[model samples]
Target: STGGGLADYIPFIIFGAVALIMTAVIIEVQQAVRKIPIQSAQRTVGLRQVQSRASFLPLRVNHAGVIPIIFAISVMFLPTIVANYFNAAPVDTWYYKAAHWIQGNFAPDTTNLPMAITYNVLYFVFTFAFTYFYTAITFEVHDVADNLKRYSSFIPGIRPGRPTEDYLAAVMNRVTFAGACFLGFITVILPIATAKISGIPHNQMYLGGTAILIVVGVALDTMKQLQTQLVMRQYRGFIT
Candidate 1:
């Protein structure tokens, strides 16, 4: 309420809240994962051959989550910020013209068709690229394959050595591609869609897709860890 009464802000508040709720729900839906089956082969245990056991490796669809969004936003604004510094330069100079172009096209103004298209396109590309880069660094197929080989575990129908790595790499690429697309959609499209459907301006509200992604991802991970701890405690108490 900037000099206005609380009554004047009620409608804005209501619509803003609804838009944020929608963003949260959409981000939660993107948390799905692809599970790869893992079979632990029989291993000799002190003159005994233990039976094989089956398990699965869960690879999250939004493995990078908020990280890519944060990175993309930071990179997306770099040119805009830099261009502002050069606005004092001579307008006739080539560098000044370049800076002017950057400032015009890089703004996140949804009402402007050309600026919105250029900004969102770059934002999506940056988010997609960052997701794959972060995923690769975090999840290494070579290490996963080596660990499986050492533990007498192997993916069904896949060999134990290089073939296993190759298969894992292929699956990871597919999963990462899906993750990249989801990140791109969440970062670039979700906000625009929210603004269009709810009639709420994004700059005036807290309808951040990154906020929902981080909150839902962290909440789910914490809950899963807590549940596992509780289960473990039920079988083996902490005291002894």
Candidate 2:
């Protein structure tokens, strides 16, 4: 009975340890923000001559980050549902056959060479497309511009308001596109690489690409929030 109790607790312990480690890694990544100093144009309430750091603007490289992956996973699932309607019994034969072919070729299993190629192509396209979609949804250049303006901060070379917003949006779009492509490659690459490097079976090595991205992204966000809290409170940051 005691041994059974111990066994039950073991899995939780293992999972907790992994979560902690993942969290640490995420924090490290998020804290990699590059802070660019922009002196404030207006003085603050307390200061006669504004004496603030007037610096520490955060530039998040992975701003769009794993959001594109989530969008891809969610959007890609809909096609499968449409295919399922065709696959229903006593339905159109050609539709069923086409659905079967697509399923056989692209379902995460049945990785014949041809199927693998098709999967890669579809995966890349969906990932890339959703990346753009997610960037538009998540990264609001206007918000950033507004925040900067409210703080009396503006980009060094760019004019304030609409011009600054446009420049920032352009930069973000370019970076987001690059990040999206990288994620697309990574979605396919990590599982394959893990399979090659580890003794895990291919199926097991297929460690849920979307899941991985979500886990990493959530962990990173949590860490950043924690870091902000610690900074506000003027305490030592996390040890683990």
Candidate 3:
């Protein structure tokens, strides 16, 4: 029989590459935000007309991008552990049956419709939950509000203090919801769809979905920074 093609190992290669690229992307994304002078109506003598120098906020979309892939892949493989445990159990025992069921149904590679559906549902739920959890841990609404207040930069139509905090929180809430849902959908469906469309096996797609998002997010952010640099140089954006 002909040996399996190298493409058969594409998933693992993709995973490895993504892991490295994501680490680099996250660090770069973090560096993108920096404080710049926003000229104020009033300023200190000898000091530039701009307000006090402060650190600008950098928002990284890839904050938890790799996290979801890691979790999903881990959960998908958990049934393998269950399988090993069950294989050692006494034959015909309930535990054995339960383990077999889990292995067969929850294994990410199988084409069993029921198991696939169940896995997708669980994946989506966990991804959604983790997305919010991570966002909450990372995004500091109070701190952002404080910084804005210190700089006297209020959200348009929002009063400084509690109102601004509330406004920022609301904006984050909406963004978190949209972003979480998008990630959840991609995590659940992209792999399955890629497998079907490309004639590749299903499990291969799990990490691919997450990789695409991270790469795209980093690329967009880099473009934004480059555009900012270009504008500073009195040149138009690359696209227009």
TM-score (all chains, Cα) for each model: 0.82, 0.70, 0.64
Tens-place lDDT digits, model 3, residues 162-225: 9877876776666667666767756766566556555656654445656666666677678889
Report the CA-based lDDT of candidate 3 relative to the real structure.
Answer: 0.65
Measured over all alpha carbons after superposition, the RMSD of each candidate to the real structure, in angstroms, is 4.0, 7.4, 8.8
Model 2 TM-score relative to the real fold: 0.70
| Stretches of model 1 off by over 4 angstroms after superposition | 1-31, 87-94, 110-112, 228-239
Which one wins on TM-score? 1
Candidate number with the higher TM-score (2 or 3): 2
lDDT of each: 0.82, 0.66, 0.65
lDDT of 1 by residue, 1-240 (tens): 565797676657766776567566655566577888999988999999999999998887777767888889899888889888999999899999999887766677755788788888999999999999999899888999999999999999999989999998899899889889887877778777777765677785464666777777788889889999999998786567
TM-score of 1: 0.82
Show pairs that collide, candidate 2.
Answer: none
The C-alpha stretches of model 3 lying farther than 4 A from their native spots are 1-63, 204-207, 213-240
lDDT of 2 by residue, 132-230 (tens): 776677778799888888878887888879988898777766766666666776676655654454434457543344465577777767887999987
- Could you tell me how far off, in angstroms, the CA of residue 149 lies in candidate 1 after the best superposition? 0.9
